[model samples]
Every structure is written in structure tokens, then in C-alpha cells.
Target: MAKADNIFNIRGRLGDFIFCQRNGKTYVKRYSGGFTKAATQNHPNIKVGQERFAQVSRYVKSLKQQLQPYLWRQKDGTFHNQLMATFLQIAKNETEKTFNELIHELDSYSSLSNKSLNKNSKIDPSTLLYDAKTNKLNLGIIPYELAVKYKGLFLEVATGWYGVNDGEIFLTESNRQYVKLDGQTKNEDQLVDFAPADDLDGQLPFVGLAVVYTDDATSESPHPVHTVMACFVETRNG
Candidate 1:
């Protein structure tokens, strides 16, 4: 069905039709009927009035479209996140904390790319060994999984549209390209010789780690002063 375009401004509703005002004239009519003069009599029955108001509320809400909000923070100390801090009323100075920490908590970090590596040579998944030699933090072999659900979309790798021949998997919808595993063919028999492993950026297929330090920003730090705040296999891309 095609959507109707009407210039009448909806004010409320009557029994079987909506109350609206056109160019300097008040009228009432259901969406499919012709406009007529609005009824001025008050609904004497309170129960009937409540039901009518409820119907009008649902109809009016259906016409609106909402947009998603994008939230982000700039630096550690600066209060640059106006979208959530002021508009959403989620941010308030109740505690003395840094802005960097606040935004990470609010926006929820997103991951980009992930890869599987040698499992035999991986470090402990629950431990973050700070390499004094390298001065960097690194993680090892992490397990991951990917689940795809298609309700009603005609899609398959190495196939084309109906009654057509295209020997490629179309890269649409988020450009999510799937690479065939080693020595695996594209469309032969649709049998599973091997499956591609999904990336583990921040989708949280498993728990991750968080670390904090109380250093004085000095060159030489003391022992036990370097304590682990949090430890897991999480890594953020963004």
C-alpha cells in the first residue's frame, strides 16, 4: 500500500476519525474518508474517553521516526562529550574520575580486526605479563566463534540472482566478505571441509582484561607497585 500525504495538522481524535486542522478550517475524518466538522460535545463516559485517547496516542506515535545517538569522548581530562553528559543526562560529576574512563564506559568499545595464532606458544589467558624488556602488553591464542542467522533473504556464496550465473559471492551489507579456508572450494557440494573463524576485537565472545597503575609518572617504579587491575583476553580495535 502507498503512504498518504496530507497537509492537515493532527490535534487529537474523535470517535471514528482524527481531529485535524487544514488551512484555517477544523475538520475530522478517518484516514480513508472525507473531512467533516469536528464534534464539540465532551465524551460523557470516562471509560470511553480513555479508550479513544489511547487509540489516538498509538496513531500519533506511529507517524514519528527516531534516530540513533552517537556518543564519544575526546581526551582524559577534557569534558567534550556533550551528547551523553548534558543531553541524555547520563553524565554527572558525582565522583573524581577521568573523562577517558567515562567515555569508554559509556560508548562501549568496538572491535575491528582479529586473528588466530599459534596456540601452543600462547601465554596464560587470565594473566597480563608486562614485558620489562619490551615495555608493551601482549596477549596470546584466544578462542572465538561466529553465528549467522538469516530469516528471509536469498543469499549464498558463489551464486548469483535467480536464473543467473555469477561465480562470486556478492559483497553487500556491511561489506562482510568471507574468505574460504585453506584448500576449500567455494560452491562445490556446499559441504563443510573448513569454516572461517571470526575476528575477536570487542564482540566479547569471551571475557577480556582491564589494567590500571598508580605510577608517579617516573622512570623507575617500585615492586608490588605494578599490580594488575584486570586481566582477560579482550582487545579493542577502535
Candidate 2:
């Protein structure tokens, strides 16, 4: 049994300030007010303590609107354009490393294959590295675009073509296993190959960029208690 004051504290901290019914059609109290009474009622559905609930709801809605602009400035928002630019620069560096490794491996394999001829052959490691690097660089672009488009959704980017949907990106698993949504299973990798691209021109998916909370328990000194973790993803669609 929580007091009215305790309830107010919970609402102020959690942002929502109130709970709703299972169907989302009815409102509940901010604290323990009338909770036991409402539960005992024979009515299958009931809204308890409407006045307080409305106050909290309105406050939360307004707060969201007020914070919208700042939220959009995060990397998961309009600033994604800048993040993508930076990602390209980093990817270029990684591609070079991958190219060098592949060249060395291929050279060793080629040398063994030509051992019977008893002749040394120049395999042009530079050309092979260039070709592989180009292919990976192109492939890398798709994930970057997808990350920008989807923002915060959980996207699994495996090899080969994939698709983007409402808020999900469909792709094959690294082990060639079936795809799974939040819980339900779907078609295997084949469906991902033919999935449709998300219409980027329409409403862009905007999920929470980061959740910041105070680490009050671990604080050694009086410092800003908030910490944030940004969510990012890679999708098959560019």
C-alpha cells in the first residue's frame, strides 16, 4: 500500500506518472489510491482516480514534445547523417586491413596449387586486395544506410541481401538458420532475400536513442548522476 506522496514520487521519476488498463482504454491511479477497491469491483473494466491520472498523463505528453528537438539531434536522429560520414571513414581503414589479410592467404593457397609446375608465379596481391576491398566497401554502405534509417531497432545484418519492413530488418543468420522476430519464428533466409525495402520518404522510424539514468548507488562524489547508452543497428537495406 503506497501513500499518495509515494505515488507522486514514482510518477515524477518514471515519466509516465500513471498506469493504464490492459486494453489501454482505462486509467489507474498514480499511487495506491482506490487500487484495492477497483480490483475488488465486479466490473471487468474500470478507470480509477481519473483526475490525478489525467494530470500525470498530460504532463508526460508535454514533456515528450518539449524534448523532441533535442532528441532528434542525437546520432540516432537527424545527426545520423554525420554518424554515417564518420562510419565511412572508419570502414575504409578496416577494409584495407581485411584486404591485406585476404591477399596473404590467397597467395599462400596459390603457391601450393602451383607447386607441381616447379615455377614461381606473381599472383598480383594488390589487384586481388583492391577487388575484395571494393566489394566489401560497397557492402558496408548498405548497413550504414540501414543503421541511419532504422536508428534504434534491433537489426541483424548477415551476409547476402536482406529486407527492411515497418520497424524490422529481415536478414539471414550468420549460421544460415531461420529468422526470429521478438519471439515468433519466420521463414528461413530465403524470405530475407526477397523482402521489400522500407519507404524512407515516409515516416522515418524514431526510437529511443539512449536511456539515461542516475547511478546514485555507485556515486563516490557529488557528480552529475546521469549516464546514457545509445542503441544502434545495421540492416540489410540501404
lDDT of 1 at 209: 18
TM-score of 2: 0.15
Model 2 pairs in collision: none
Error of 2 at 98 (Å): 21
Per-residue accuracy of model 2 over 1-238 as CA lDDT, tens digit each:
2334222222222343454433324343544344466466544433332332343344334423433322322223323333333333333444434322322232212221211110111111111110121222112222233233333333221222222344333322221111212222222121222212244222111111111122122212111111111111222233
TM-score, every prediction: 0.18, 0.15
Candidate maximizing lDDT = 2
What is the per-residue lDDT of model 1 for residues 142-231, given as tens digits with 9 covering 90 to 100? 111001111121111111011101321111111111222223222322221111213222122221111112211211211111111111
The predictions' CA RMSDs to the true structure, in order, are 23.9, 26.6
